[model samples]
Target: MSAFSAIGDPEEAEEDEFTPGIEPQPTWCPGCGDFAVNNALKKAMANLGKNPDEVLLCTGIGCSGKLNSYFESYGFHTIHGRSLPVARAAKLANPGVEVVAAGGDGDGYGIGGNHFMHTARENHDMTYIVFNNEIFGLTKGQTSPTSPKGHKSKTQPSGSAKDPVRPLSLSLASGASYVARTAAVNPNQAAEIIAEAVEHDGFAHVDFLTQCPTWNKDARQYVPYTDVQDSEDYDFDVTNRQEAGEMMYEVESKLYEGEVLTGRFYKDDRPSYGQEKRSTGEMPEEPLAERYYDEDAEWERCAEQLIDKHT
Candidate 1:
C-alpha cells in the first residue's frame, strides 16, 4: 500500500446538514456526565439554527476543555480558568457569532472565579456553562471548589474543610443578566436551558450539576435539576433576580437537600456589551480589514518586534 493514500472523490459526498469534522470519538470514560452535557450543547446549537463557523465553543483546561475536540464548530481549548476572558474577547471581536464558554467546576470556580464574576458584571454577550461535578474529575478525584463540606476525596481524606461554592446564588449576585441551573441527567431540560441561554442577548450562565460516576457520589441519589415543577408543593418563580438568588441559596446551601430549582432563574433586557461597543464606535465604511491590516509595512514591523522578543 502507498504511504500516502488517495481518496476516490476530492469532496465529501452526501453533505450533512450539520458540520461533519467531528468524526473522532470522544475520549471521556463511559457513562461520564460530560456525555449528556455535550449532547445538550449540540442540540442547543441545532435548535438555534446557527452556522458552525459563526459558533465559537471556547473551553478551559480540564475534562471540559476536551469538549472542544468533540465539536465541529470553531473551538478554542484555552488555559485553565481563562475560558471566560477568551470567550468574552471572541464575542467582542465578532458580535455576530455565538460564543460559549465551558469548563469544570474546579477550573471555573477555583481558578477562574475572578473572571466569572467580572464577566457577569460586565454582561458580556456570551453563554458560560460550568460542569459542576463537585470533584475534580480530570485530576483523578481531587476536591474541587464545589465539593460538599465533609465530603472525603483524595485531597480531603478527612473530608473537605471549606464550604462548597454555590454558583447559582453567586452568578445572580454578580449581575448575570440571564442565570439558570440544570442537571446533565435531564438532557432535554439541559438542552432547552442552553438554547434559551443562546437566545438571550446579555451574559447568560448555567451551572450544570453533572455526576462523575467514577470520582464522586452516587448518580441515582443526585436529583437532576429540571424545568418540571414538582407535584409536592414547591414554588419556583425564577423571573425575579432577588427571588432567584434566595431560592438558589436555599436549595444550594445544603448538600443535596431541597428541590432542584431548574429553570430561567433570572433574565433582563439591559444594554449588552455589544450594544455599548456599537454605540461608542462609528460604523466602518471599507470593512474592518481596511482599517486594521491594510498596510504590509505595519504588519512587518509588528512581526519583527515579536520575532526579536521571542527569538
Candidate 2:
C-alpha cells in the first residue's frame, strides 16, 4: 500500500472537511473579491468530492497568494510568478495529487508569463487560476498586466499606454487544453468553472476576474456577465480552436468596454505531458514519491547524467 493511501478517500469527503479546524478569518478588506474565490474553491472541491489531503494548492506572491493561508490543504506560497513551476514539479512527482496553481495577474501574466506559456505548451496536468483584479492590490494599486490601457495608477500616473494582456486568448494560443473565465461576483459560475478545470486532464487556465474595490474602484465588478454557453448572442464551439480563438479575441476586447463575457472558452481532448512521457517510457508507472520509499529501488541520478553529458 502507498504511504499516501492515508489521504482521505473521496467517498467520505464532506463540504466542511476542507475547512481548517481553526479557520483564520481572511484579512482582505471589506468587500474584497478574494473572499468569493476562497468560498467558490471550497465549494467546488466539496462538489467534486475531493478530500483536502488529495489536493495541493500552490499560490504566487500577491494578495491572491493569501489563498494558501485560508485554504485547508497541502499549500505552497511561492515567490512571484513561480507557482506554476512548483505545482508542475509536485504533480509530476505524485500524479494522484490534484494540483492547482494560483496567483494575481501581475504575478502570473507579468512575472511568471514564461512559465505559464511553457506549462500550457507542455500540457501539464494541473489547474491554473489567475486572479485578475486589473491592479496590484497588495502592492498599493499599481497598474497590473491586465489593467486597461489609459488606466491610471501610482506606477502609471500619466495613464498606461500599453494594452492589457489578453488572458483567455493567450491561454488558448499557448496550448492550454482547457480554458475558461469567471468572476467573483458570480460565485455559482465560478465554482462550476473551477470544478470543470480541476477535472480536466490537461493544462486548465481560468482567468478569474476579481474586483479590487479598495485599489481599483474604477474597475468593473464584473456584474451582469453573459454566460457564453447559456447565451444565444455568442455562439462558438468550444472544441473548435479557430472558433474559440475568435470568441476569445472579442471577449478580451470587450472586457474593458463595460461588457463582461464569462464561461468556458476552449477545451481540447489531448494527452497531458505526463501521460505522453509515460507512454514514451520516459516516466515510470509508479509515482516518484512511491518509488522513493523502496530501499532496493534503483534510481537514475539526473544530475550525474547532466554533468557527464557536459564533461
Candidate 3:
C-alpha cells in the first residue's frame, strides 16, 4: 500500500441558504482541551464578522500547530518555534491582513521562547496564542516550560527541579501591549478575549490553558477560575503596570497550588512596530503585498533595493 495517506474528503454537509459547513476533523484526542481553542477561534471570528480570506493563521510544530488546519484562513504551518517570525513577516508584507499565531507551551515557551519575548517586546500587530497545557502533548507527555516544579514526566521522572516560566509576567515585562490568560473550560471568555486581542492595535498575548488528558491528567484541573475583571474581590486596574504585575505574580503562584486564576492581567495603548516604522518613513505606507497586483511592475526594481542594501 502507498505510505502517503491523507484525510478523505468530508461528507456532504447540510447546507442552508447561506451556511454550508462540515465540522473540522481534527486529530485531537477525546477530552482534549484543543477542541475548545478551535471552537473559541471560530466564535471569535464570527463575532467580529471577519472573512476567512482576510486573516492569516501561522502555527508552529506541535499539537497546537494543527490549529491552521482546522481554522479556515490563509495558513502557514511553520517549523517548531518559528511561527512568530513567519507571522511577523506576513503582517509586515501586508499590514491589512489580520495575523494570528498559535503553538503549544513547548513550542512557544520552550524552543520558541526567545521569539515570544522579542515579539512581545517589539509590540508587533498580531495575536499570539500559547496553548499552556503544562506538558509537551504532541511529543508524548514530556516536561514542558510551563510544567510545574516537581511534576514528574517520562523526561523528568524524578520530577522537575527547575521552576516553571511565568508566562503572564514575562509577557508584561517583555512589552506585550495586552496580556491575558484563559482556560479551555471557559469557551465564552476565551472567544471574547481572542476577539479583543485581534482588535487590539499592538501585540496581544494570551496564555491559553489547555489540558492534555491523554498524557497529563494533571492538566485537566484548570477550571473553577475567577475572572478578575468581573470579581469585586480582585480590584486591580488592568491598565496599571504595577497592579497587573502584582496580580500576575499572585496568579502564577496559585496555579501550582491548584487554584486557576484566569483573566486579563495587563493592557497598554502603544503603537506597534509597524506603526512606528511607518511614522518614521522606515516602512512604506503601502504594503509590499500590494505590489503583486501590479503585473507590469519591474521585479528588478526590488532586486536593485536588495543590492543597495548589501552594497
Candidate 4:
C-alpha cells in the first residue's frame, strides 16, 4: 500500500484499545482537568474506529505533554511550543496518518503563538488542542497567556496587568478552517468536538478550558457552561465567517467574566495544504515517506546541493 493511503483496516475499536499496554499511571494531580482531555480523545478515536497505529499524537512540554505516555499511539513528545511543526511534517510526509497536536496555554498561545497562527493560515489537516487553564500548571502557577487581567500568580504577585489572550478569536482570524471551544468539565462535548475536529479536512483548533485547581484555584471550574448549539440564547451559522467571528468574540469576552460558553463556533470547507500541493503537482500523489523506503529511488539532497554550490 502507498504511504499516503490509509494504513490500517477499519474495525470496531473499544476505548481500551487506545490505552497503553503498560499504562503509566497519570501524574496529574487529583481533580486535574488534564485527565478529561485524555479520556475524551481516546473515546473520540475509538468511536471513529481508528487504530493506534494509524494515529500520530504530538505533544509539547507541560502537563498536557504527558498524553503521549498514556495513549497507545505513534507519539512524539516534542520540545516546548513545537508540537505543531513536528505534527505538520509528519502529516505532510504521510497524509494517511491521523495527526493530533496538543499543548498547554503557555506552550501554545504564548511561546508557540507564531507557529499556531501560521499552521492555521496554511490550513494543515490536523487537530490542535490547547489546554487553557489560565495559569501555568506544570511549572507551578505562573501567569499564563490566558490568565484573566489582574489575576494574581506567583509570577504576578501584584496581579497581571496584561489582558488575557482571546484564543477563539485569534484562531478564527488566523484562518483555522474549524474552530471550537470545549471544557474538560464537559467530557461529552469535548469528545464530540474532538471527533469532528479529527474528521475535518483542514486545520482544526480546539481551545480546551481546563481548570488548574492545583495552581489557579480562584479560576472558575468551567461549570454551568451553555452549549451554544443546544441553547436558545445563541443562534449563528457556523459556516458563515461573519457570524462565527461575532460569536467567537462574545465567547472570549464572556469567559473572563465568569460566563462559560462551549460548542462548535465555526467550520469551513477548504482544501488542506497537502491537498492543494498534490492538486497543483507540487507534491507527489504518493507520500514522500514512501520514497525513502525504495532503495533505488532517486532523491535530491538539498543540503549537499547547497554546500556544493557555495563551495
Winner by lDDT: 4
Question: For model 2, what is the alpha-carbon lDDT of residue 70?
Answer: 87
Taking the tens digit of each residue's C-alpha lDDT, what string does model 4 give over 212-240?
88988999999889999999999999999
Q: Candidates' TM-scores?
A: 0.82, 0.96, 0.90, 0.95
lDDT of 2 by residue, 117-159 (tens): 9999999999999999999999899999999999999999999
Q: After superposition, how far is residue 285 of candidate 4 from its true place, in Å?
A: 0.7
Model 4 / residue 251 / CA error / Å? 0.6
Q: Best TM-score goes to which candidate? A: 2
lDDT of 4 at 81: 98
Expressed as tens digits, the lDDT of each residue in 228-266 for candidate 3 is 888888989899999999999999999988888888888
CA lDDT for candidate 1: 0.76
**Model 2 RMSD vs true structure:** 1.7
**Model 1: CA > 4 A from native:** 1-23, 218-221, 224-232, 282-311
Q: Itemize residue pairs with steric clashes in candidate 2.
A: none
Ordered from best to worst TM-score, the candidate numbers read: 2, 4, 3, 1
Which tens-of-lDDT digit does each residue in 1-311 have in candidate 1? 21111112222222132334656467787778887788788777776665565578899988888887876677888999999998987777556677899999999998999999999999998999999888899888999988877888889899888888888888988889998778876888888899899889999998887778888853343564546354344465667666777777776854356456566667887888777767777432222323243455232355787799998
lDDT of each structure? 0.76, 0.92, 0.86, 0.93
